[model samples]
Target: MSRTQRVDRTAVRTRLDRVTDPELDRSITELEYIDEIEIEGESVAVSFTLPTAWCSPAFAWMMMTDARDAILEIPEITDVAVDLRDHMHAAEINEGVNERLSFDAVFDDADGDIEAVREELDEKARAARQYRAVSALLDGGATPEQIVGLVRKDLTIDSEGRTTVRLDETLSICIESEPIERYLEKATATGVANGTDAGLFVTPEGETISPSEFETVHRRGRLAATNMSGQGHVCANLAEARIGSASASD
Candidate 1:
């Protein structure tokens, strides 16, 4: 490959960072699942391993396919390959994902649709992120009523780390943008915050949050966040142990 044609390692890692472990709802890269990245001309290959050999095949499939798709999104890249290593079903996942086969086609005995599973996880992630966003707004002095009443048109997110939440015609407050931005990403994905009239924050079922139900709804969101965080810690410990075992064996 010529100088300009050389694929950037950082670019590939940046794209891979978007691929998250479904159960943990955390970036696979952040969890140190990425084992290697090899570039040959316009083709890039990624190898990853999970925290355990028996990690859910569905979750492994999702991460592998997502990583391949994310890397292919780069305009300069023409072909991408994902290799899932160390998992019990790694071979099936690797072949299925590379061949672009459906989950059912790959695993005929699988119970339900993988897309349905993905949607469920995405909703959970949205709820967890919603908790953080709402907490940020509350800490910024916005009331529960104002938050429940917010619509998609009420937020103004600028380039900086500040987001302006319009409580009403005359009252608006600024808060840190990270939480809101993260929430909006998943909210839009799960069809919670799409239109100007759509409620900016909603229940896990994607219903408008009433004032009376705000506390309960917020608590549910908090629980989702806590559950995800707890799973993340468990996965992190398992991954660390795997790494240590590998080092010891060497």
Candidate 2:
């Protein structure tokens, strides 16, 4: 094989980073689920293991499809295979992806638009992101009404104050303002109304709510955040166990 035909590891990894786990809206790579990346002449094979063998077939298919699509984006690659390991539906998923079949084509009982699912997840992620920034502002002594009326320009993050929230060397995320950025990105991507009239926070339906309704919205957002956090904890544990077991067996 010519040197030019070899896969570019860095480019492939960067591409994979954009392919996220549908449920968590997080990169599979960041979750450390990618088990292998093999380059053979013009073909590149990517393999990943799930947190559990019985993980949702829908989510498994979503990741596999996204991964294969990402790899195909590189003009240099002519062929790619996405492999899902140790999962109950691995065979189905592998065949579905390798054959370029639709999700419903592989699963007989599947119904409704997959885009609906993606949109729902995107909304939840948007809410979760907004919750972080709002809570941060609240802790910094901003009022509910003030938050409800805020525009993007009204937002400001003081690095020192954010660092103070960490207060420990191990707390690396305290100073980062990704939540706000994520919220904005999701908002823009989904075409949710933003700016002075609608404020930084908007309903899942993409409409502006009154100041008096902020409490209810804020409380609901917190609950959504809690549920997402709990799910995240469960996934983290499963990933740890799966990764550990794989390592031991190796």
Candidate 3:
């Protein structure tokens, strides 16, 4: 019998939290897409489901690969196996991810490049994140100039336990941690600098969206957010139905 390294369930879940649906820009965990997780010896097994069997193979493949990569970060995990439960291309994706094949190698002559698709979605996510962060500041009475000037080190929990982010020592706005978490994750993925003084409202190219263009950027950001929200709701409903069907069958 192989001796297994002690596995922490919390740690495993924490790692998986980093994996997000490419289009939705939401955590697989938050999206309720991670169906199950099992561990044996140094091997980790994760079974996940998508919104539907017909979800885009490229996006589904990314989620699976991201999960496997995230789990492998644990020193105790020497192997990771991703099972795509009900996807149309589940078999192809599972095999491709396990074998570490490129998207083109997995789907030869496919219409789109996976990297390009990923970048497109990443830009949308960054726009959504920046809009949400800046909007929260606006709601809390921050001027447009102040919102644009905000930096990463501005995020902190205040004495009253509310999440607050600041543009300077005396200019802080109260907000929740969810949007901040969302922004930071996508910011890093989009090549934005992550540091205390790094600007919060940056374009996909890692350049700060100028205050003069704030209105246009905010409008575009809101649109991006609305599109993702609609997609997320559809996926959530489909996932619920799938889960219900599985339970009835069981």
44-161, model 3: which lDDT tens digit per residue? Answer: 8999878788899999888988899999999888999999987788889999999899889989977888989998899898888878866777887888788777777777855554
Q: lDDT score, residue 77, model 3?
A: 89
Q: Pick the candidate with the highest lDDT.
A: 1
* Cα misplacement distance, residue 228 of candidate 3 (Å): 0.4
Q: Give one digit per residue, the lDDT tens place, for model 2 in 1-250.
A: 7655566788889999988777777888988889999877778899998888988888888788888888889888878998898898899999999999888888888666677877887788777777787787677666676667666554445654342222123321333465666667777667663653446788656668688888778777787677777887799898788767776754
Model 1 C-alpha lDDT per residue in residues 1-250, reported as the tens digit of each score: 6537687899999998888888777888898889999988889999998988888899999999889999999888889988988889888999999999988998999988899999999999999999999999999999999999999999999999899999998999999899999999989888887999988999989888999999999999999999999988887788788878886755
lDDT of 2: 0.75
Runs off by more than 4 Å, candidate 3: 1-5, 151-178, 194-198, 203-207, 240-250
Q: Once superposed on the true structure, which residue ranges of model 1 sit more than 4 Å away at CA?
A: 247-250
Error of 1 at 225 (Å): 0.6
TM-scores, in order shown? 0.96, 0.75, 0.83
lDDT of 3: 0.82
- Cα deviation at 200, candidate 1, in Å, is 0.7
Residue-level lDDT for 90 in candidate 1: 88
Off by over 4 Å in 2: 1-7, 136-143, 150-177, 193-199, 239-250
